[model samples]
Target: MNAIQLKQMTSAKGFIAALDQSGGSTPKALKQYGVNEDAWTTEEEMFQLVHQMRTRVIKAPAFKGDRIIASILFENTMNRKIDDKYTADYLWEEKQVVPILKIDKGLADLENGVQVMKPMPELDDLLKQAQKRHIFGTKMRSVIKEANEEGIKKIVDQQFEIAKRIIAYDLVPIIEPEVDIHAPEKTKCEELLKKYIKEDLKALGKDQKVMFKLTIPNIDNFYADLMGDTHVVRVVALSGGYSQDEACEKLTHNHGMIASFSRALLQDLSSSQSDADFNKMLKDSIEKIYQASIK
Candidate 1:
């Protein structure tokens, strides 16, 4: 890679955005913000509302700073136009936020305490779509509901398999094997997760690499070794269900893992608020999350 390309990768270190969510996440968010339930019934209406909401958040004046290095988008929103430009282009051209897509279909039935990705028959097409839209990377979700060896192994294998394909498409992959916060053995699961991630990364040729967006382990600083791995370009954390304060506190203890939060980053802003109010709230959240990232 050229020096410029290498520098950009290294600079992609903190506050990656995660706007690509599906299923219950949308409805849950609407309820939390006191939006009317009737407005969310149809897919058409839901997508329109979600597009508007995500657009405001992504292009808000508050995001014009350098702290938020990247953003993930849902497929539907990726194609929408804002100010006569595609959403992805607008983010890059205007705000300098890297665009990424969430490609996995939502989760399916729980099996062996692991939530599997629903059958995604169109991931290849999705990658092509993301590329056409100028997306810089892709992310997918797999959850470890329990910390058993069998469950963790299944989660890791499935994620890496898809992650491999993402790499082949010449786009970066944020491999997320999330351990549920409610799991009884969060530490054990994290240890197992580290082991499997290291092994998978080792088998790759020297040139191959991927980023990780992992759950913050129950024990603080547990992921220091993995964060320091040469093969791991960047390590980011998910908020799961934690409140903003809680998420930021735990994030401070985990060295080198910065925030890529979904809910925690959005909890303070509401659709009912004025645009100015929303922006102010968003600015405050970004400052707090960014501070937590560097703390």
Candidate 2:
């Protein structure tokens, strides 16, 4: 997992050529080599490779360059439970690159890992509103209602708090809101989001600037809505079941911060042969993604 090992196994020349002529043929190339067709898992593997290579690069005293931002996307407590140990282990083992943990949990769960949990910033504000009966509680309807304007504002606040605490640990806290654009509750949520935006601008303090972000799914048109915002909100399209190039193209076109791929990619890697070919495939995909992301 060193830079030399990665470069040698990936074959930089072949990788570059693959990417260049990949012209949309990358999927075919990958399938021909028995690479997983699911973009999400494929992208995840690529990220893991970049992380390993980047770690090696940073350890070299002679190496000096911009740092890479590595992130993991987790949905639901199940995903969190599964990924948290892996992420924690990677963070502990890796060096240099920033670790961004994106989760779809309540503010409390988001804040649980770090210190300075008291005076819960965003959750506190949310609870204040919820206490007034101005928002929803933990019930299904309430949860849905609260995830909107009033609730989102509070979540945004909580994100700020988490970001502050994460920075103290020298890591990055990524707040990933799993917004369903096509849900029946979209109108209420949208209204709340508008109000939340105004409130966010006012509550956003010096330390909280650009530290929080919002992630929406299954919507391509909403990108325009977020374009004019002052706060940093990243729109990520779910590409788990799609083609990698299509996912990459959409992410590129929309200027997305991250693209989530299929979880199956990990399963594939786990079953992959431990021989040199497996290593080469892993290395090549990693470098390809790194180059794509940087561009």
Candidate 3:
């Protein structure tokens, strides 16, 4: 399987353009964003641009691609702060593609917090309303048994519609669903996976290719089970709180394809003293990982 890791710092739109130009190379862009030469660009700027591009593509009638995996921070407040207004604007306009709201990781400290789910009442209500207006719900995990069926159905319907659009444009849109099972109970994780696989099969049928952004632990044991399965599975391990090298080693040892060091990498790139150092690190890391996976 070919492995690709989308760094959060690379704007989705820019990345897509880069892919079009370099056939998936990370360091080059044929069309530039036309910014001042000396201006320091932050990861946040890239994220905002990507979000804007995604919104445009979603609304466009013609767009083509086989599969695209978007790696984003769901519940991290630091990630949310930059795009809050953009989300609010979409909500005001009644657009269905609202950002997935996540519970602040710190909320786990509160009493009885285990029962506290994210997607606060306001966002939850908005999602419910959006389902009525659009074919798909914004939340990806609605397929799970614990999620509201009505909502899940809407999301599935919307996904089917999007797939149709992809086909119409001669593109294949593989919905890459991701979930953070970091703190959940083992049983809960298993249940979620079962539902995910079932729904995915229903969506893709038997012989179609499907992509997923998964954490290491959730799919570790099931790796072999998926080995000759009809669909192509690409697992991206979260390297936020763990050792990136260790995670990559384990995934590669288990026959997994790609591993991402996004969080740690972004931090280093953002704080690096020199632009040359940052660029070199980004280029070298991507090449090293690509070579390792291929070998």
Query: Against the true structure, whose TM-score is highest?
Result: 1
Q: For residues 128-195, what per-residue lDDT tens digits would candidate 2 score against the true structure? A: 33223211111100022233444566644654555544434323233333344344665555456545
C-alpha lDDT of all candidate models, in order: 0.81, 0.34, 0.34
Worst ten in a row by lDDT for model 2: 14-23
Clashes of 3: 3
Whole-model lDDT for model 3 versus the true structure?
0.34
- Give the local distance difference test score of model 2: 0.34
Q: Which candidate comes out best when scored by lDDT?
A: 1
Global fold similarity of model 1 (TM-score) = 0.94
Off by over 4 Å in 3: 1-169, 186-188, 202-208, 218-221, 233-243, 291-295
RMSD for all candidates, in order, please.
Answer: 1.9, 14.2, 13.1
By summed lDDT, the worst window of 10 consecutive residues in model 1 runs over 1-10
| Local accuracy of candidate 3 as per-residue lDDT tens digits, 1-295 | 1112212211122111011111121121112322232332664454444443333332232211111122222222112222344332332233322222221122112222122222333543433333333211121221222233343344345444443433333222333222333544534544445454556456664534443334455444454454345554333334424454555455565454444444333323333235455456554544444433333
